[model samples]
Target chain A: MDFFSQWVAFQTIVTKEIRRFTRIWVQTLLPPAITIALYFVIFGNLIGSRIGTMNGFDYIDYIVPGLIMMSVITNSYSNVVSSFFSTKFQRSVEELMVSPVPNYVIIGGFVTGGVCRGLAVGGIVTILALGFADLKLTNIFVTLSVVLLTAAMFSLAGFINAVYAKSFDDISIVPTFVLTPLTYLGGVFYSISLLPDFWYNVSLINPIVYMVNGFRYGILGVSDVSLWVTYGMLTLFIVSLYTWAWYLLSRGIGLRQ
Target chain B: MSSALKISGLKKTYGNTFEALKGIDFGVQPGDFMALLGPNGAGKSTTIGIISSLVNKSGGKVEVFGKDMDTQPYECKLDIGIVPQEFNFNQFEKVGNILKTQAGYFGIKPGLAEERAEKYLKLLGLWEKRDEMSRMLSGGMKRRLMIARALVHEPRLLILDEPTAGVDIELRRSMWDFLREINEQGTTIILTTHYLEEAEQLCRTIAIIDQGEIIENTDMKSLLKQLDKETFVLDVQGDLEKVKSIQGYRINLVDEHCIEVEVSKGQTLNQLFSDLSELNIEIISLRNKANRLEELFVSLVENKGAA
Candidate 1:
């Protein structure tokens, strides 16, 4: 295929992926909105008032970046995992497998769809956060870069999960056990500075903490970790995960008979 | 003319054991309609899967329109299309969307994709259900939908794995007509079907695979000619009492009005009709006791098993 043809194939897959989630917006989009809204009401407005300020900002304000990042992480990961796995289960991925579309085009298209949904939900949750606290972006470039890179990273991770998943249960296992725990301990609700030194060091080992703190740095210019290190870690994860997913796809792992 | 598809020394083994295909070799000339026949557990599906790149081959060389599939898979894939035995489309998608999405996979522009989708849908009698979700369509419609999807790209070679399985006879005949028309228009087709009559009616070349090997690969006429005798059931207009061993024909009286005749090669049916006429018996109708191809297929497989 020529460059134009490859581009068209990529666009087709992305459009189909977007249409699939948007068509079932009640199931895919609405729940995240409601969940984020509830978090704002209960965690931000209700309990944040009692907690007062942390890290030189109001409790609600400090957690806004973390919550928004969390939404992006979870939605982006789930979107690709569920969509790709469903195709595998239905055997409809054969449509793409037998076509002239390259594996990279397929992978790029799904990741693009995941990023779109992630950014969308993150935007919605940001709007919801506005209802609880006045939030401002300290650095627009850094904020956009962190969210985009994080979404891409998790989207690639989801693709890998889908590739290895033998059943639907396998897809959720990572999210339920590894992802949820990592997100909570990543300092979504509190600064790691409040933790004992030993726990703070351990929290630093969790990848999500750097993402949350990097995004926090982007939004408020305050981070528990160095901004340079956070950016480096995000880039490293994205590159490695993308390379691994591509390898798996080219090998036809968990797909071909 | 160049061959439409060529396979040389193709082989596949599942895991560490279970050899599915063992060094099978064949080729289909451009514009030829060929049948890849086999019983369950035969390597027909495996060969088709390897050609379509759905299943990786353990060893072999496959060329589509002279392009090596291993090296130029994208180009080879673009030149061919496949309708698998099972329904593989998204059931939740609209019929039109399914075809359009398939066209898109081939990098077809939206306008052209729409036009081609409309053409195939209408040809396959699916235009009316274009707006309906695919799952809502009946079984036959779903099968037709798969055909339309496969044809959306207008591939030069089309591979159908049991395209008419479970379809009613009427629909099956119509599908045969459609397939014949396409083949006449210069599209090479490779079909795998359990119905031997379907192969006899549509394909000119036949390849029978069994026990991971191609046991028979020849022209249809030549394969049928391998049968030494054919059984025919005749309905007589007058009462027939007893079986008679006529010269060069073995006859059995099935009932008062029916008789079975086994005609060997080099025997003329005209002589039997003459004898029946002399007996004051009129022939109402006559038909083959079994599909000629079915008999040939069974004998070939049996011979291979015995060997």
Candidate 2:
């Protein structure tokens, strides 16, 4: 297919995907906003009053970026995993597979859907965070770039998960076990600087730490890791995940017999 | 003058041991309505799956309108539309959106996609339910929706795998008419159906596959001609005691009112009717004991099993 044709196909998929999530706004959009609202109320207002400043910032403000990153990660990951797996479950993915659209277009379209949802829910959570704690721009470029990369990376992760998933139950296992734990431990609620030496070193290995700390740095002008290290981690993860996803799709793994 | 579809030694093996399609080869001329008949596990679905790129081929070549599938799969897929045996579309999507989305996948623009979606939906009697969720459609309506979705791209080669497997007789006949209409309009159709009567009524050519091999591939007339004799049941309004035998045909009394007669290729039913007339029997109604193609299909598959 020509480039223009592929673009149309890609746009069609993205539109369908956006319509899918928006059509079920209660399930896709509302729950994350409500859940993050409660987190801000309980953790930021109620709990942060007891804890003093960490990393030279108020406890509530310190946790805002982490909370936003968490929502983005989970929402982005869940959107692709659930949507793509549902497409496979219903066998509607065949509609794309049988068409003239290339594999990259398919991947690009779904990833865009995931990114959109992630950013959307992220925006909602950020607005909610403002009511509990004041948030100011530390570096608008860093903030936008880190969140975008994080959402795209996790969306790709979810796509890979959906591809290998055989059953609906299989789709939930990764997010519930791997993603939830990784997000909680990735310096969402605490700074790695507060951890014991060995554990602080271990937390550095968790990829989500880079995202959370990077976003925190973007928001608060403070970070446990170097800006260069954060960018390198995000870039490396995005490139590797995108390439891996493209390879799997081209090979027709999990999607075809 | 390129064939609409051509399969050369097409092969598919599932896992390590199960060979779904074994070096099958066939061709459908442009605008030909071809029936691919087979018993269960005979690789009919496998061939369709491979052609639609749902299943990977183990070996050999598939060419659609002279476009090599391997070298130009997008071009090949662009020319063909397939309706799988199972309902493979999203049930939650609106009926109209299903057709529109399908057209979009083929890179159709919004304006033309809307026009074609409307065209096919109306053609298949789905216009009223266009905005309704597809899952709410009845079985027959769902079948029609699939047909409409397959046509939105206006493909030259349309393949339906058992399109009317469970449809009521009336709806089945209507679907046959719709399929025939498209075939008449120059879309080559390859249909796989368990209903031999459907095949006999709609297809001009036939291919019978068994045990992953094509046992018969010929025009429908030629395949039917190979049947040495045709058995027909006659409902006669007379007592069996009045009739003893027929002259040139093998006759058996099925019941007091019905009798089965095997008429050979060179024989005439006029002779049997004359003999029945002599017996003072009045023919109420007469019909074939089985569809001609059904008999041929059973015999062909049975012979393959025996071999």
Candidate 3:
């Protein structure tokens, strides 16, 4: 099939995946929103009252984008991992295997599903953040671009995880050991400028730093790294991951018999 | 007829030193019903897996309808449908949706998918089960559902792997009729089974695999004819022990007053009868006991490695 037709097929799989999540709104869509709200109550209200603003915004405003981005990363990653793994477990992946659909369509269909869940949770978290902080968007394009890049990156990561995973335990290991640490140190609640120089330098290594700052630059017009560098790094990360993902898919890495 | 599939030196070896397929070659022609017969772990599933693109091959090549799989898989795959031995449909989805989604994988539109799904489900006696989750279906129904899902796109080559292994005899016959109807309609079918009778009744050509090698591949009748040995059951007037001295024959005592002897073709039964008569064993009845198809199937896989 041509690119246009393949994309239409990808769209169908994506819609089915999205409907699966939306149908279970209580389990998938609602939990993260509520969790972020709880974070706002304890971390922003109770905790921020003692320490004044570090980035010249209220503690609630400072943490909003980071929390939302974190939710997006986890949701997008989890959605693909769980969904793809379930297909593998149930042997339903053979449906695509037996068809003439190219490997790229399978990857595109699955990654888009992850992106939808990520964006859905991110969007819901944004609404929750709205009630807590008076946030503004100085650059709409940068804000949307950074959010989308983050989604694409994590969704691709999730796709890779699902491909290599043999069992349910294999999917959970990265989230617990790798992803949680990266998100915690990504400068979510605090600016790197407030940290010691060594720690601040180390923070630059986290890919999430560029994304959080990129979105922060879009909304608050204040950022630690130059917006270009953040945008450049995020773009590079997305391309490199996408290329690797496509290569793995084309070779039928863990999907083939 | 031109070959529908041609395989040459196909091999698959995993990273863990497990060799699943060891350079096997076979072919099937258009509208021919071919059966791959083997014991479990005889590489039947692995062979089907590689053909359907589910398994990665380590070496060699496969061509479908004259197109090399590695060069233009889409051109080859467009006409092929694989009904895997295992149930591979989504248990969470309704049967109708499962079949429709499979059609969509081939870029077929929803309307076309629906029409095709209805046609297959109804034909398979599963139209009412359309709304039920696939996991809820019985084992036989689920197997039929796999066939329906495979043919939703009207593929020209249908590969059925053990389609009716565990089903009842009646259902097995019904499935054979159904498959034969499709085959008559110009769908070349490649079936793999441990059930030799299924092959005897359905396939025109048969290949027997044992210990990762194609031991035999020929017309079904030819393979059966190779066993030109005849076996007969004799109902003797006297005790069975009296017939033990038949010259140039192996005697098997079925029960008292009856003895079964195996003789090479054209080696006269009259010779054995007279030899027994010299031993004072008079027979009341004589019956042929050789099932040639079974004999061929057994002798091929009888721990003798390759034929």
Best by lDDT: 1
Task: Give the proportion of true interface contacts each model preserves, from 0 to 1.
Answer: 0.77, 0.78, 0.73
**Residue-wise C-alpha lDDT for candidate 2, range B165-222, written one tens digit per residue:** 8899999999989899889989999999999999999999999999999999999999
The TM-scores of all predictions, comma-separated, are 0.98, 0.98, 0.91
Candidates ranked by TM-score, best first?
Answer: 2, 1, 3
Clashes of 1: 0
Q: Relative to the unseen true structure, what is the C-alpha lDDT of residue A7 in candidate 3, on a scale of 0 to 100?
A: 65
Taking the tens digit of each residue's C-alpha lDDT, what string does model 2 give over A1-257?
89888888888989998999999999999999998888887887888888888888888999999999999999999999999999999998888888889888988999999999999999989988888888999899999999999999999999999999999999999999999999999999899999999999999999999999999998999888888888999899989998999998888899878
After superposition, the stretches of candidate 3 with alpha carbons farther than 4 Å from their true spots are B15-20, B230-251, B257-291
Question: What class would a CAPRI assessor give candidate 2's docking?
Answer: high
Q: lDDT tens digits, residues A1-257, model 3?
A: 66655766786688778877887789899999999999888888899767778678888788888898899999988998888888889989888877778777877788888888999999988888888788898999998988888887888888888888999999999999999899888888889888898999999888888888888888888888888888788789778877888888788878885
Task: Report, for all candidates in order, the number of backbone clashes.
Answer: 0, 0, 1
lDDT of 1 by residue, A1-257 (tens): 88888888888888998998899989888898898788888888899899999999988899989999999999999999999999999999999999999988999999999998899889888987888888898999989999999998999999999999989999999999999999999999999999999999999999999999999998999999998888899989988998999999888888887
Models sorted by DockQ, best on top = 1, 2, 3
- Native-vs-model 1 lDDT? 0.92
CA RMSD of all predictions: 1.2, 1.1, 3.3
> Which residue pairs in model 1 clash with each other?
none
